[model samples]
Target: MDADRVNTHTDARSETIRSATLELAQELGFAKLSIEAVAARAGVGKHTIYRRWPSKGALFLDAVLSSHETILEYPDTGDIVADLREQILAAVELLARPPLDGLFRSLLGEAQQDAAISAALNERFIAPQTQRTIDRLEKARDAGQLSPDLDLELAMSILSGPIYFQFLITAQPLTHDYIDRLLAALFAGLGPRP
Candidate 1:
C-alpha cells in the first residue's frame, strides 16, 4: 500500500483503539482496564495497543485526553466573559455526557491511589486547560480588562472551581442558564472594584 493509504489506515485504527479504550474504561474503571480487554473491544490484536502505548496507564491517558479534546473547546475570544462562558458551557456539557463523564470519573477515582495515574491525569488532562486559562487571563490583564494585580493561576482555579464543585460535589444538573448565572457571579467578583 502507498504511504498515504497506510497513514490513513493507521489513523483510523488508532481512533478505534482509543474509542474502545474509553468504552472499556467507562465500564471497567481504570484499575481493571487491561490491554487484552481493549484489544477485544476494538477487535484488534493486543499487539496493536501495545505497539501504540507501552502500558495501560499510557493508553488510558491517551484515551482520556483524546476524549477530553474531542469534547471541550476552550474559547479565546479576548473578551474574558465570553471566553469563560464558552469554556464553562463546554465543560458542563462534557460532564453530562455519559461516556466521557465515566472516563473522567474513573480517572479521578484511580488517581487518588496511583501516583503514575495521578501524574498522567494532571499533566495530560488538567494542566493544559489550566495553562490556557492562565494565558487568557494574562491577555485580559494586558488588555486592561482585568486588574494588573490579579494572579492568573488563582484566577484560573476560581474560574473553574464552581463548575467542578457543582458537577462533582453538589451533583447539580448544569444548564446553560445556570452557567450564565454562575459566570455572572464569578465575573462580578473578578471585576474591578473601587
Candidate 2:
C-alpha cells in the first residue's frame, strides 16, 4: 500500500519485461517482435509494457544494448607493441563468443535500415570503444613506438576489419589459431615498416 513498495515492484517488473523482450528480439528478428508477445512472456499486462517503453523500436533498442556485453578494456602497458597486440586479441576474443556474435550481427543488420538505431549503436557502443583504442595508439605515437602519423580511425579498421571479414565470410567457427593469424596479419601490415 506504500509508494516505495509500489516503485520497487514496478522496477522489478520492468526489468523482467525488458529481459524477456531482448530474448524474444534475439530469437525472432526485431521487425517481427511484438510488445504483446513480450508482455505475455513476462506475465505482465500489455499496458504495463506500453507504460515502460512507448514503442517496439524503443524496446528492441534497449534489449539489444542490455543483452550486449560491455566492451573490453583498453590497457596501456607502456610498450605500444604489447598494448596493440593485447587489443587485437581482446577484439578477436569478443567476436569469437557466440552470444556476442549473434547480438553483434543482429545490431549491425538492424542498423543498415534504421537511422535512429544506427546512431544509437555508434554513439552508445562503437564510438567510445574506438576512441579508447585511438587514445591508446596516440599514447604509443607519443612514446615513439609507432609512426607519428598513425590515423586512429583507419588504425581501428585495420584491427577490426579482418576479424569481421573472417567471421562474416567463412561459415567456419572461430578458433584461437584463427584469431592469432588474423591479429598477426593485421599487425604485420600496421606495425612500423621494418
Best by lDDT: 1
RMSD of every candidate to native, in Å, equals 5.8, 6.4
Per TM-score, the best of the predicted structures is 1
Model 2: per-residue Cα lDDT over 54-170, one tens digit each: 556656655655544354667777977667667666665654555446655666676777666566656655677788878888888888877677687797777766666666766
* lDDT digits (tens) for residues 1-194 of candidate 1: 12221121237898899888888887887768899999999999998777777567667777666656755555777788888788777776665556566566665666677676667656666787888778888888999988688877697678777777777778777788888888777766755777
For candidate 1, give the lDDT. Answer: 0.72
Find the 10 residues in a row with the least total lDDT in model 1. 1-10
TM-score of each: 0.76, 0.69
Over 4 Å off, model 2: 1-14, 25-32, 44-58, 67-71, 79-96, 169-172, 190-194
